[model samples]
Target: MNQLPQEYYQRLEEIQAIDFVLVELTLYLDTHPDDYQAIQQFNQYAQYSQQLKQAFETKFGPLQQYGNSFSDAKWSWGTTPWPWQI
Candidate 1:
């Protein structure tokens, strides 16, 4: 298999980091639903996550399946590397 670019890992790491933050915020909000600050932060992170995923998918491929990602005319399932591949 061909080696992937450094940017791929970088973007993936960023997404993971944002996702972690989102998860933590979600848990906090579950118990503290009145915290408007936390809610705002969660929304910001969620938007950023979507943007990052879209950019990553445009260059690499879909990060998920089951209608979560966009696809071209040809099938991309077998073309892109899986998360565990790298």
Candidate 2:
């Protein structure tokens, strides 16, 4: 398989890190239901994740089979090289 671009891996890593933080914040919020700070941080991370996903999709195509990530210009999802194959 060919190597994927560094930016693709970097973006994926960032998204993964954000997801991890969101999960941890969710657990904390569950125990401390009134922790407004944690809630705010969680929301921020969630929005950031969405933005990251959108950017990734726009540049590299859909990460998943379903969603708004698919382009109308052409079916790039199946045609574009997979990350592992790149």
Candidate 3:
């Protein structure tokens, strides 16, 4: 769940793993785009990253808002207190 207080730490690990996979696949594909294995891994990483981003935004606020703010259970507008306040 994104409910963990250690969600940031989990995110850090996920980021590192995704970065490594992306870097390795990109380097491999530089001269070998036809490598189906690398292409598959790249796609997998991209999907995983997108899921993580959604979880982060759901737990925290969006990186930025549209015309209307996202409604969250814990934080909303000025009702959201600072980290210490939480």
Please give the CA lDDT of all the candidate structures.
0.92, 0.83, 0.66
Q: Model 3: per-residue lDDT, tens digit, 1-86?
A: 12436665576567668868788888889999899987988999988876765676666554335633465766564433333443
Candidate 3 local accuracy as lDDT? 0.66
Worst 10 residues of 3 by lDDT: 77-86
User: How many Å off is the CA of 52 in candidate 3?
Assistant: 1.2
For model 3, what is the alpha-carbon lDDT of residue 22?
83
Over 1-86, each residue of candidate 2 has an lDDT whose tens digit, in order, gives 45679998899889889989999999999999899888889999999998998898888777767665657487777765665664
Candidates ranked by lDDT = 1, 2, 3
Candidate 1: worst 10 consecutive residues by lDDT? 72-81
RMSD of each: 0.9, 2.4, 6.4
The estimated TM-scores of all candidates read: 0.94, 0.79, 0.58
RMSD of 1: 0.9
lDDT of 2 at 61: 78
- Model 1, C-alpha of 16: deviation from truth (Å): 0.6
